[model samples]
Target chain A: MRKLTLPTVLLFIALALTTLSNAQDNIWTPETHMKVKRIGGTAISPDGEYVAYVVTSPVMEGEKSEYLSQIWVAAADGSFNLQYTRGEKSNNSPAFSPDGKQLAFISQRAEKPQVYMMRLMGGEPEHWVSPIPTSSL
Target chain B: MGWSYGGYMTSFVVTRTDRFRAASMGAGLPNLVSMVTTTDISDYLVAHMGGEFWDDYDTYEKHSAIYHFKNVVTPTQVIHGQNDVRVPFTQGQEFYEALKRKGVDTEMIVYPRTPHGPREPKFLMDVSERIAVWFEKYLEE
Candidate 1:
């Protein structure tokens, strides 16, 4: 068995410290801090021109508890500010058809996630499913 | 759809690591894949689509997809991770090796230290670019 000299002990400690520092250098740091807890409605248009996503905010009980959400659209450059849906109903999961003419999304207007479709040009939404059921959604 | 097997697609763990924690996070770092077990066990899958290996005499000699790979007309590409948790890189490596041995033009990319989602943007881009190149080279031809 080899003797545990003071220098050998110090060398081991130094090596451990160096390894820890290297690990810290490689650790990930957030590029941006998003306020929203969960982000839904990640949709890329068929033409790949626009991306629409929703930012949801919770509601408090006895104070109307409105399901609030904002539908945001941005160019491939992540610009072009627009809110397609801004209302009491929480909106999410914007889907575009292959042609990119039509858009579909989910809403919590009826205390459930009901599929709603609206034309890209401009029009009222048409409800496809009634009384949508989702457990953890 | 026949209503059966309560343990089919209905099964999924929100976090994969929680399900197979024993595998350890980096047992296979660059690869993270696991196909949920089909509800039906051995007998059902084999009878329906045939097994990977067969016991019949003539069928053994028959050119098939899994074994008699030479019969494959479709151009194939194999991808594996240095550390794959579920399906494991070995499986992909073996498939690619077999195709190579048969003198088939196949490509493979073994990503290092990544899981299913590939959180890193560059890695994701690499995967997409690799797939695009493969499709462009094979499909266009």
Candidate 2:
């Protein structure tokens, strides 16, 4: 029978401690979960060359956390991707026009959500419709 | 197209305009009246609708996309999580059935064991790919 040495025992203990530390570092916590970006609300362009989608992530304000969603466009062939909207407010529900020249979506830049349209080629989003106020509904 | 509140907006917008060639509604509530009754967040919906469904049926019906289904001309694709209690799977069904009855092009895709949003990576990819295919089929110039 072989006897274990003191240095070998210490080495085993050191390895176990390192493994435990690594496990703690990789642990999944609620804060980690909140930081994950969520992708959703996909809209395909009329020509099927591009796809519009929403990406939402948690925005931390002091101790409070809120989600901010923005629109993103990606080519069907995976050649390019770009963020379509920016800022703190949320923008979502993208719809491509029949001609695929314009994209419409809902934005909460004001007190209520309203439809906004923008040319796919370029330019700022034009506020298109405000169907009904939330208070009225 | 969108999911949850986005889905509701997509469903509502299609009923109001025909400018869009195609739309994909995910976990959307087309019928606010039925949504209040079946959704897990009934109180939230009722509050948003301004009152209980029984107390203000007219308001609920007016806001519901189902009431305006006759005005919808755009081909729509409905997607839902089968086990979704948030919006409920029937919401998608109602929209799909209305489109079918109206002789409009429509299809419904239900993901089994999914909740309000797809958690499985494969299901998520399927949704993105399907939406692209659906639009191509209807929007080809």
Candidate 3:
């Protein structure tokens, strides 16, 4: 055992106090809400080549605060990660087609929410419509 | 098709199509007007629904599953948390009762002390098993 000097004891107390204060500063609060990142709604490609998920962060718009959500794509092997969609409104609920050639998701780019399909290779997402009106369902 | 919102979708879909043999609705809202009154976000619902129940009764009733229950032929399994406040337990109860009264095959599993969704391990397992059993039974037929 080593002898405890007065300065050494004081030094250990100071370090402990610093850590406690730092932890207190990191407590959850409305001000720290923006610093939090929420991740959810995962959709894996049929071929298992990529994983699509939503990442949301709080945003302050004029007088209101709302979440800004965007879809992110990641390689199955964890080699690459990138933002998949860049729309002004929130984009989420990703679903890949059975053949893995197309990705479908819901977006509000057209004022009303609609299903948009995009090729995994690249290109702008196109609105997917069925032969029958969805409103009839 | 949905969890909370999906449950609502499943409930609405059955009234429109009998193409599905079996469906499971988990914590769904069947009555939009009642939902607005009961939900914690009453003001938010009023804004989303465009107005209060009295202001736009037809719109709320038009989208509500309760009004369309007469057309549902598909067998449905309604699962809900007894303590769910967001969607409330009454929604599931009302749907189940309507199905029963109509002589449609239906079952309701209300997990005690559960909210919105089953978070406890035991309740989760119960829900999974019940779902699997319900689907398998319908598939076998």
lDDT of 3 by residue, B1-141 (tens): 457999999999999999998999999999998898788878987898888889779999899999988899989999999999999999999999999999989999999878999865445546767887888888899
Off by over 4 Å in 2: A1-137
Chain A TM-score for predicted structure 2: 0.78
Q: Each model's TM-score?
A: 0.34, 0.51, 0.51
- What tens-digit string does per-residue lDDT give for candidate 2 at A21-87? 9999988654555557999999999899999999997766664345789999999999999999998
**Interface RMSD values, listed in order for every candidate:** 13.7, 10.7, 14.7
Put down candidate 3 lDDT per residue, A25-108, tens digits, no spaces.
997544464466789989999889999999977655564345667888899999999998885687878899999888888776
| Every candidate's lDDT | 0.52, 0.88, 0.85
Sort the candidates on lDDT, descending order.
2, 3, 1
Pairs clashing in candidate 3? B2-B6
TM-score, chain B, each candidate: 0.52, 0.96, 0.96
Off by over 4 Å in 3: A1-137
State model 3's lDDT: 0.85
Residue pairs in clash, model 1? A41-A93, B28-B83, B29-B83, B30-B113, B30-B114, B31-B83, B31-B84
